[model samples]
Each structure stands twice: as structure tokens, then as C-alpha cells.
Target: MALRISKKYIHPPVSFLNNHFQFLEISEKITRSKIQSLLDEAYESRINNLSRSIGLAEEALSLSKESADKSFIGKSLSHLSLFHMIIGDFDLSINMANEAIENFEDLDDAKGIADAKYTIAGALYKTNDFSKGLTHLIDCLATYKKLEDYHNLARVQKSIGTIYEFFGDIKSATQSYEEAIDSGKKAGDLNLQSNAFNPLSGLYLNQNKIPKALAIIEESIVIKEKTEDIRGLAFALYGRGKVYTQTKQFEQAEQDFLQSIKIHEEMGEKLGWAMSHHKLGALYIKMNRLEEAREILVRALEYSNKNKIILIKFKANLLLHEIAKKEKNYELALKYLTQYVEEKESVINDRTAKVIEGYDVISKMQALELEANAQREKADIIEKKKIELDSFFYRISHDLKGPITSLMSLNYVAKLEVKDEAALKFLSEYDAQANRLNNILDGLLRLTKMSFNEDSKQEIDFEKIIYDCIASYKFLANYELVEFKINIDSKIVYEAEWALVNTIIQNLIENGIKYARIEDGNKPYISISINQEGDVIKITATDNGIGMDEKTIDNIFVMFFRANRKIEGTGLGLHILKRAIERLNGEISAKSKLGEGTTFTVVLPK
Candidate 1:
């Protein structure tokens, strides 16, 4: 007989605030301090005394509004939203979050807006609004990445992974979890790490990677224990119980589930406590302990019904139905089966309604598109304005370059003529400033040219272009200390605009070398790999260098974004690379860990 492993596990929404007590500076210090203290109390007692926590958050909100401090008001609303979600008041949570977002936006607070969105996303998840939840999560991910907030980034990534897993996109889910793990490690937050680990283990288990699943879940359990995260430990133990049940270690599975239940009951986590009881009952049924299974299943059913946990309620009824049949109680089996079917249909209907709601949104969007089609004249006018803007940039870039070049030439002559150390120093500074301006103008010119020019397609010589890129960077400091490893398939030749391809490859290599760590005993190396799979060309550039934090990686492709201040750069290399790839309808992504290294991957069509 095939092993039947239960896949129903509770993944609670992350309820912790990103910046709970870190309030912005306001004129009213006394009010601000009072609000902060109230929020601190709310967060501390959130689990143990939920009603008190809610009261404290409400008090903070009232105090914040009285102070007329928008930042404090937003923070208070965000905390209240989180507290609401913890108690399963999802609609209230979402309403509070939306209000918080409005307040944050009025102040142009990106972090505040993101924090509120994160809370909204969690609430949306509980409400089964996965589409909206995923959208909010993606937005939160971008803000967290740009802020280089690793702790929140990890949390967002894990949430994204869960959504992807729900959609049955295992590959994307796995990638998201892996990214979460990376960010969690970078943040040095063991609790965050365990959050990712638990879900990741479940994914592995789904794939029948039993040993791998067991190992990761155990690792999470250890971290949760060490961190004294009683809530997290309960979840971890519940997950481990599932793993043990799958492995046919029934006694170990029972023990883990019982411990999880004890913890959940102590913490007053009704949903988790009930879920653990249901799972333990299921295990008993598997072991043919019919009487034990029947007892626990009935208890689980009552708790689930009281909590309105529809999923668990239906599942427990089904288990009871099976136990009744085993005892040859036909009438009782029929009754339980009827309840199971009715409850299960209710769940299906709810999910169906949600799907229909999504379709309704799409239908509205299509109607909007049709309305937009009637405004072609306005679109044409906007296009013309865009063209004019491009022309202005192109002209200005050229216009500025001449003066910049002249300034540089004059500075060079002044350096040659000036004999005094002070005068030479002044000339050197002038020269550097001139060069920086020149580089900026050059970047502007390239950007404008990309906007106007047509693609000049040619067979890309990956090897020669890579070699040229490295040689051009030879003048950079510590260039001699870097090792370049290039690997390209001899049979692969991608047909694309040479300049675009070169731009992508060169910037990646330059970024690696420029940021290469020069500390004693550190051997910096750049590895470039290129290959073609079917119609897509894949290029990866990796470097063991002074890697970036999450924020830098997110903004790396933005115009004039500089990650390293010490390195002499135009801050336009990666931006140009991104633009060039976009021009070719290609995609680019980066992953990095501070003090470890970075890897850039580009996927382009042939």
C-alpha cells in the first residue's frame, strides 16, 4: 500500500511589526513616548493577553491622533492591524492596514506603507484572497529589498513561497524559500530562518525527499528551541510529527503531536491546538486504534466548529466516518459521511466563489481596456510627449559633453603648469569632478540612444566580448588580484544586438571586479558561465567579492544607483545593463549576501 501522508498544516500569518517601537521624530516628545510605551506593551502581551494588547494599541492610536503625528498614527494603525490578524479578525485587520497605508502615503513613508501592506497581505491570506494577497506581498518584497531589510525580506519571501506553493508552482515556491533562507541567514535571525526552514521541509516532503525533509525540519526545531520561540516550536513540532507519521514511526509521531498540542493549548492557540489534535487522530486511525481515533476526532471536530475552522471540521468528520465504518456502525458512518460531504462542499463553494471573483476582476479590466481603446488620440499625444522628452535628453547629453570635455582639458593643462602643491591639489580635484560629469553625460547619451535606436542584430561572440570587458577593467585598482573564470558552450551562438549583449556581460563582470574584496587572505574571483537551452540563452556571472545587502541589490538597476562609494564608477553600469536587456525583451536577476558574494543571471531569447 502507498503511504498516505497528510499535507494539511497550519501556516500562521506573521504578526510581528517591522518597526514596532522605532517611531519617527515628532515635535510632541511626551505624546510620542507615551504612544511608544503603549505599543511596546501591546506587542509584548500580544499572545498571552490578546484583548489587553488590542486595548493598548487602541490607546496608542488615540494618543497618536491627539498629537497630530501622522507617523505615529500610521505605526499605531499597523500594530492594531497585526493584533487584529492574530485574533482572526481579518476584515478588521485589512481595514486598519488600509487606513495605515493612507496615513503613511500622506507622509511619503515608504517603509510605513510597506509595513501596512505586509499586514494587509497576511489578512488577505486568511480571507482566501490569494491574488490580492500575492500582489501586496510582491509590493512589500520590493520595498523590503530596497530598504535592505533582511528580516522583513525573509518574512515576505516565505509568504510568497507559501502562496506559490498553493498555486502548485513548486519550482517558484522552492526558489522563493531558498531566497528566504539566504535573506534569513544574512539577517542573523534564527527565528526567521526557522520560519523558512519549516515550509521548505514540507516542500521537500511533498517531493518524497524524506531524509532531506526530516533533516531540515529537525534543524528548524533546534533553532526554535534555542531561541525559546514557544509558538514557533509548537509549529515545528507539529511539522516534525507529520514527517514521523510519513516515515511510519507512529510512536514518535504521536509524541511530537502531543507535545505540539500541549504547547498550543498553553499558548491559547486554538487553531493550532485543534489542528494538532486532528492530525494525531488521523495517525491513530492509520494505526487501527479506532477507539482512540474516534475520541480525538470528535474533540477535534467540536473545537474546529467552535473556532469556525471549516477545513479542519470537514477533515475530522471524514476521519470519524472511516472509524465508524471500521466498527460496522453503518448508520453512524452514514451520518458522519453526510456531515463530511456537506462541509467539504461548503469549502469547495467558497473557493469557487473566490475564483469567480478573480474572473470578475479580469472582466472589469478587459472592459477598462476596451474603454482605453476609444482614447487612442490621447495615447498618441502621450507618445509624442515621450518622444519629445527622449529628444530633449539626447540633445542635453550631447550639449553637456562638449563643456565637460573642455573643462577636463583645461584642468589637465592647469595640472601640468601648476608647480605649487596647493594649486596642484585644486587642479586634481577639478579634474576628478570634470571626469565624473563626463561619465554622467556619457551614461545619459547611452540611455537616450537606446531609447531611439533600432536593434542591430548580430551573432554575439560571448568569448571575445567577455575577454574585452576584462581587459578594459585592467586599469582598475586591485584588478591584478582578481581571477576571471569564463565557461561558454562551444556550440552555442546567440543572435542578438551585439551592443546590448556586450552591455549586459560587461557590466556584470565590471561590477564583480570593482567590488572585489581586497582584504588580506581573501582571493577574489569572477566566474562567468554562458549556455543556450532551446531558444533561450542563459548567462550567469558570479563573484566572490564584497557583496551587497538586499537594498543595494534591489536598487542596483535604478539610474545612478551606487552600491559601493569607494569604487570609482558612473553608477550607471547596471542600470544600462538592465535597459539593454529590456530592449531585447530579456530578463535579469541578482542574488547576493553581504560579505559573501553576488551572482547575476540573464535570460535572453535567440
Candidate 2:
């Protein structure tokens, strides 16, 4: 005889339910509630959550094997991967994802395979192999597209956009995000679509395209509210707040950031709450509210550390450094600033560097092609000019040399003929002026040569460049008190144009020394530091000097950029440096505070 069900439709007693239920039906499928319960317990960590998750998964694996239900087996495999990810065993997660993928593939289950690939991509993303992660995600996206899995495709695109954003490629990032939004709308996935728009807006904000960013984010916020995805709404609002901060709309930024923090707390998204706090701190600092900034930033730093979000932690520290400086707290400022020094070092081996390297190679090929094109065009336009051009250069070289040599030779002759000290001084001045003119011509010649070089780039020692610049200029002694720091990762090396690298560093370092504040007329100072992350080296030259305003900054690297003609300059140091660095496909930027200091960073491909 079977046991009859005696309990009312309340929560059934465990023993009765277990005994009276048809075990086959109940165990064959899990309800949404049951899955959520397991996931929550697993996420919360039941001291032995790994063991519990594994146990349940293994039990389900056995059951599915007995039932010969491949679908259930695929679910069990996914569960194992989730547990692996939860335990921070990413290698195991990768293996489990692969296994799950194989199982799902065998079942010809596109949906199951999509999920598995996403898990694989997530693991890859965590390990900092963002490119590989992005590849797997794109594969997942293609599968979703075939299965009409618009929702999941949107999710994948959002993440891919994030990787692009991280590398500072706003164009690619925005394109990915817009595709996500379109896909999400088609699938009625407002939450995911809103999520995509929010981050995309932040990217536009960084580019100073305020109107575009604001409009998109506002629409996203509206969608989030309509969908009632409270956490999604919070992040969207928070992202908008970040945009406002960038635009210096401080009041709105603070309110939005605080509102986001409140919502994040209510939703139990602690990491999001942490990021909001840090962003709020940045706003406070901008408003000259240092105390609030410091407190909030500290709270953020603690939370970010626990979550393993180093990017937020580093940025928070950078802001805190600024706040401390405002309070005349140099020690704390220095400490906080040092935290980012390591992370800035980690910018090596990223996708951006790889892309830049690839771009360099492609550009070389393109340049060759362009040269051919230009030659063909020139031949067509000026068939008779080659003889004339050659004759002109020959005449000019010979023509210019006569006067230059005569002037220099007369200066030397005068020195030998002069008997009085006054005549000797006059000859010395003439020689100096003539030599300066020759140096200018030499520089122009080198510049012209750089425009058409076909030589293969080779590795050069950065350490040697630093030392030679110092010894050749005797800049250290010229400065009364200088702070010089060189932090090079000994193994950091690059395949680049050697002569150009030397010239760039020489010009940049010379500028740093010249512009830096000296204790007295006899004092000059400069500091240099180098650090490595994966394959790139970051070189920084910092100094206590009078820094330029935004107007001057806007044109610092433009051709013939002169901030003050009263100050002796060719208006070409940074301009020439930019051209040389660009030839190597390198990036250089300056960060400065008026009457505070300046630091220039150069990122070269390795």
C-alpha cells in the first residue's frame, strides 16, 4: 500500500514529503525556487559551500546517468563549474566549462553550449587574458544569434564592450554597446540593454562628448525604471553621476552618486556600493571638500580590496592622494600615489599595446604602399622635376656650405689673429652663433631622414639612454637640488627605432630639467622612474615646476607650439618628440597641477 498525503497545502513536513512523493518525478526536475535556494546558499558560502555544491552536483550527475538524461547531466556539469568559479578555482572552472561544453555539444543543445561558453569567457576574463575571453564570448554570441538567443547575445556584447572600454578604445566599445542595446530591445531585455547604455555613456563622457553621453544614459535610466531592475537602475544612475563628475557638474554628480550608493546598499550589491562611494569621494575632492572625500575614499578602498577590483582601488587612491595634498598631508598623499605606481606599471601586455604594435607593423606596410602611390603621383605630376629637384638639393647643399664654413672658419681665424681679450671674446661669440645655426640644420636633416627610413627596428637598453643623457648634459650638477628616480623592470625591452627613442627621451628629459624649479639660479632638478607590468615599460619624468594652464596644455605637442616666446625655445621640443614617438607608434601624455608639479608618461610598445 502507498502512503497517502495527509498534509494541507502549507509547507510540507520534510519527512512526509520525502516519503510520500514520487521520488522519480521530483528528482528528475528542479523548480526555480529550488535552484535559487541552492545558488543563494552556495553564493553565501555555507562554510563548506564547495563541498555542498560538489555533493549536490555529483548526486545529480549520478541521477542523470541512471536516467540516461543528457540534459540533466549538462545541468550538473554547469553546476560544477559554478561551484569551481565560486571557490576562486578558475582553472577548475575552465575545465568544467569545457566539459560542460562537450556535454552540451553532444546533446546538440545550443542553449546549454551558449551558457557554457559564457562561463568559459568569464574565467578567461578573470585571469586577465581579456582577448581570449573576448574571443570565447564572440563565439557564444554567434551561437546565441543562431538560436535566436537575443537576450544572451546582448549580455555578451555588453561584456565585450567593457573589455574594449578598459583599453581606451571608445569607438569599438560604443559600437559593441549599441549593438547590445539594439539586440536587447528586440528581445525585450530592457535590464540588459539599460546596463549596456549606462557604461557606454561613461565612455562618451570620458571623451568629453557630454551631450551624447547624457542623452543615452537618461534613456537607459528610464528603461531601468520601467523594467523595475533596481540594481540595474542604480548602476545606470551611478554611471551618469560619473559623467557629471567628468564635466565638473559637481552638485548633480554628488547627488546621483549618493543615490546610487543608497540603491546599491538596498539591493545588496556591495561592490557597486563600494565603487559609488569612491566616485562620490572624487566629487567631494573636486568641490574642495577634502574631509568627506578622504572618509568615503577609505571606505571604498577597503571594500574594493575584498572584491579584487584593483582598478577602482587604484583610482580611489589617486583621488585620496589629491585630497591629502589639499590638506597639506604630503606623507599620506605620497603613500596613496605610490599605490597607483604599481598598477600603472601593469598597463603592459594589454590588448591596446598589442593593437598598437600591430598598427605599427600595418602602418609600415601602409607607408611603403603610400610611398609607392606618392611616387607614382609625383612621377605623373612632375615627370621633369626629378632632375630639377636633384639639381636644386645639390646646389643648395653646396650653396649653403660656403657661407656657413666661411663664417665658422673666419671665427677660428679671428681667434688666432686676435691679441686682446676683447677680440677673443668676440670671436668666441661668433663661433657659438655659427655652431647653433649648424645644430639647427643638423636637426632638420635628421628630421627629414626620419620621414623616409626603411631600417629594421631593434631592441635598445633604456638604462643606457638615461645614463648617457645625464653624463652628456651634466644636468644633475646644473640643478641645485633634484629628485631623480629610475624604476626599470630589468627585463623590460622593446623592438623600436633606437635613434628615435634616444632623441625623444633626450628632448623630453631635457625639457623636464629645464622647466623644473631650482632652489637658486644654479639649481636644477629632475626625477625619472621606470616600471614594468607584462611587456610594456612606463617612464615618468616628474618635477616641481610652474605648470601650464589648460590653454597651453591643449597645444603642447602641436607643431611650433610656443607657450611663451619670452622664454627661449624652438617651440619644437614636445612637437619633435611627438613626431618621433608617433613614428614608433608610442603614446605620451602630460599631467600637471599649476604651481604644484608636472609628470609626463610615455607608453611605448614592446
Candidate 3:
């Protein structure tokens, strides 16, 4: 996110994710502790790993939000928030969601806000705050509806339906899921339909409608395959295996369960793998294959305990205890059951802790955003004040230029009309003084224009412009008969503000003329050159001049800082030149020897 955490970053599309499920795959390969940690990341949604494909996503999101990365912030922040949701940290999820919610206004990024809303609603649903969550969820639905984002809308509806199913609101749940399935069909999004089909199939299975449940789940597997939804396919396979187990179709049930396990192993979905093992254990028990059942159940218990997944632990505990009870190891059975309850309670306590943490995070982020917005407002006020002050100064100086120049020029013309020799000398001195006033006014006007000019940009030939400026000034420049040279290969072009460049060049030349040496025996010279190196273009104006001390050179760029007030007139040229060069994304620096020469070089991007 930007400072407000409400700016945008570009995000990877869901289509990018549609290709595979890395979370499940990582689960299969790593050690139990590592796999558990990865799940914690996925659940906490904070784990960043490359081998863990989901971490690839977090890395991308993080890159977008760092510093003022406006380009990708919108995408990353909300993605991280969704990560929080997937892991069940509802408060953190909500905090991220709310931060993302205002991104649409930062830019006209409706899709960004929509994604944030979706994440927010999901968090709310996860934490059992269904009412307010539904509002955001519904708002997201409406946004997606307008966008015609059928693929995403279907997912949201399906999630809502799943929650309803969890709450035992069968009718509403079925309708909502059905709507999602229908929407998915229209959108050609088989993933959403496959997701919706789970609850539908699960509902039927629980009611003992074996054939209907089997048919729906089989269809879900087909859709999951079509969509390349490996995770959904694995779950669907599990569902089908359960149906087979219940129907006493032992051979088909074994085939389905084993197939599910193979896929889970490949995908590294620990939860899926654990479920597969638990089911295998149950099926073995049914067959009175006690030894095989015990082996698989024990492994399942190990994974469940490591992951701190209470539900899995509970199921594994019941199976292990029953196995013990059947063996007449009553004490062992009781002990396993006791451990199961304890593990289950621990998982619940952890979830409760996360909920509290999430709330605090949300509150803190909201406060930070509010403060940042206040600072932004203050910054805007300061900028406005600066603009107004500059505008007033520019307007007054601009209005004075024409009259001042006219008056000075008239005095120059009157000097030429003087006839008497002594009077002519006096008039000529007056002319020089008037010309000084004219130079001052001209410099002032250029400074004012450079400060206030607001015009469109164009690609400029920097080399040509500098050469032409030198040519225009060559004759009028009243320096001693200095050896003036132009040493420039002028093919470089750059994006620039034209008037600004002209003013900059004009000022650099004027400064060169004003400072050039004037002595009977001294070599007085000024040279102009331009060069390009990669993306940068450089211009150098060199002069064998009566140069300033290092201290004066340092102060020269400051507005109205003159090395010699006796030289007369305004000292704003270098300041104006600096501003002009900066505006065109160029830089200027001076290298000089006081009794030898000065080289003023300007560098700009091409």
C-alpha cells in the first residue's frame, strides 16, 4: 500500500492462480513440522516461500507495497489481506481489506476496491460476523455484477453458501450454492461450480441419499478436472470414496481413497493427505484389518497433532481409541480420548487469540491511515501557499518588464541623437546605463517566466538548441576578442519543456559573457559543447574568465546572489537556469579555476 495503504499496485490475475495449487503440493514434500509451518503461513497467510508457490504470490504483493510503489500497491495489500482470510486471521484480514477499500478512490480502480471488499466479507464470514460481512459481500457482489465478473461473483456466492451450510440453514444454503453453480456455468468458471457442488453433495450424503450424492460428487470431479482445480478434485475424490465406503463397495472405495492419497501426496496438501489416511484407517477398520488401520491412523494422528488441527486430531483420536477399545486396552483408549479433547481445546484457544490480534491490527491500521491522511492534507496546504506566493511575484515582475525595457531602449536611442562631442560622450554613458537597466529587466522577465511557465512537453534536440543559442548570442556578446568555440556533436534528443530549455541556455551564455576575461594581453575565450552518454545528455559551457572564488561560486545559484554588486543589475539568471534544468529533469554543475576558466555542464536524460 502507499502511505495511506490505499494506493494501487498491479496484482496477478486469478487466472494465474487457476493453473495450480502450490499450498497442497508443499504439504506433500516437506517434513511434518515444515508442512505444518507452511499451513500456518497459508492460514496466517504470511508465509513467503519460493518452493511454497503461495509465497511467490506474497513476494509479488510485498514488492508492490514497499515504499511508494504506487504501481502495484493496490494489488499487493489486498492480496496479503486475503492471505490472512485464507488462514483465518479475520481481524488482520479485515484491516487489510479496509486499507484496500479506499484504493478505488486513490485511482479510479474499481476492481481493486472490489477485491478488497471480497476479502473483507470473507474475513467477516470466517470470524462468524456474518451480518456485516454479508453487507460487504453483497456490495462486492454488486460491484462484480456491474463489472460482469461472473467468475469471481460465483466464488463469493459459493463461500456464503458454504457458511450457511455450516450453520445448518439447509434451504438457504442450497439455494445460494445453486445460484453460484448456475453463475459459474454461465461464466464458464468450473472452479466455482465445483466448489458449490461440494456442499450440495455433502448435504445429500449426510441425509443418506447415496446415489444422488455420488452423482453430484462425480460431476464435481469432472468439473474440477476441467478447471484444473487439483485441490477440489482431491476433495471430490474423498467424497466419492466416502460414498463407496458407506455403500459396502469395498474395492471401489479402496481405489478412490488410494487415488485421492496419490494426488494429495503429489500436491503436498497435508490436510488432504491426513484425511486420506484417516479414511483409509476407517475403511480398514470396517474390513477388520486392525493392524493396517492402526498403522495408517497413527500416521494421520501424527500429522494432525503437528498441524494443531483440532478437527483432524478429534477424528484421529476417536479412531485410535476405538481401535484400543476393541483390543480391550481400555486405559489406552481413555488416554487417547483425553489427549484428543486437550488438542481440540488448544486449537480453539489459538483461533480465539488470533481473532483478538486481528481486531487490534485493524484498529491500529485505521488509526495510521487517518493520521497519514491528515498529514497529506497539511502537505497540500503548504503546496498551495507556495504556488500562490510564487504566482504573485511572477505576475508583478512580468507586468513591470515591458515598461522598464521601453524606457531603457528610448534612452539608448536618444544617445545616438546627441551632436556635441562632450554631450555625445555623456549621452553614450547614459545609453550604457540604460542598456544595463534593459539587461536587468530582460533577466528578470526570463527568471519570472521560467518560474511560472506551465506548458505542454515535447521531445527536443538538446544539441541543436544549444548550438542555435550560441549562434544567436555570438555577435551581441561584448566580451574581449575571446576565442569562442563550439565543440558539440549535436544529435541527442530528450523529452523537455522547450521554453524552459531556451531560458536555461540563454542564462548560461549570459553568465559566460558577464564573467569572461577583459585584458590587453590575456586570452579571453568561451566555448559551448554537448555530448550524450547512454540515457543522459550533457552540455558544457566553458569560459577563460575572471572567475569567482569558491565561496561566491557556491552562492551563485542562490537567487539574487551577486559576486560583485558593482557589476550591476539583477543576479537571478543562475537561479532561473537551475530551476529550468531541474524541471526538464536535468542537472547543472560548475568546475572552475579562478584565474583560468569555468566549465558549467548540464546533464539531462534522453
Top-TM-score structure, candidate number: 1
TM-score of 1: 0.53
In candidate 1, list every pair of residues with a backbone clash: none
Whole-model lDDT, model 1 = 0.85
Error of 3 at 172 (Å): 31
- Assess candidate 3 and give its TM-score to the true structure: 0.47
lDDT of 3 by residue, 335-354 (tens): 98898778667755654554
**Candidate 1 — which residues are off by over 4 angstroms?**
1-27, 37-59, 349-606
Q: Give lDDT tens digits, candidate 1, residues 1-606.
A: 997765443433344232333333344676788899999898767645667888999999999988788998999999999877766666788899999999999999999999899988877765457677876877787689779999889988998887667556789789989999999999998888888888889889889999999999999999988877777888899989999999999999999999999887766666678879999999999999999999999999987777566668889999999999999999999999999999889877776665565445545645766787768778999879968977998899999888888888888887888899998988888888888888888888887788897787888888999999899988878789999899999999778888778788878887898899878689999999999989999999998899989888889988888888878888888888988998899999999999999999999988
> Per-residue alpha-carbon lDDT of model 2 for 1-606, expressed as tens digits?
997775574577788777767674666455433544554454333222346657766666666667776676677677777666544457787888888888888989888887877878766665455766766776787688778888888888888787777666778788989999888999986777788988888887888889999998999889877766666778888988988888888899898998999877755555568778988987888898888888898988887777655667778888888888888899988998888676655644454664465345435645866897899898877846744543554456446757888889878877888899987887788887787666555444455455556567888788898878766666433344555566666877677778888888788677766666654453345677777756666778787776678788888887557766645465667876877877778789998876666778887766
Worst 10 residues of 1 by lDDT: 12-21
**TM-score of every model versus the real structure:** 0.53, 0.47, 0.47
For candidate 2, which ten residues in a row score worst on lDDT? 40-49
Clash counts for the predictions, in order: 0, 5, 14
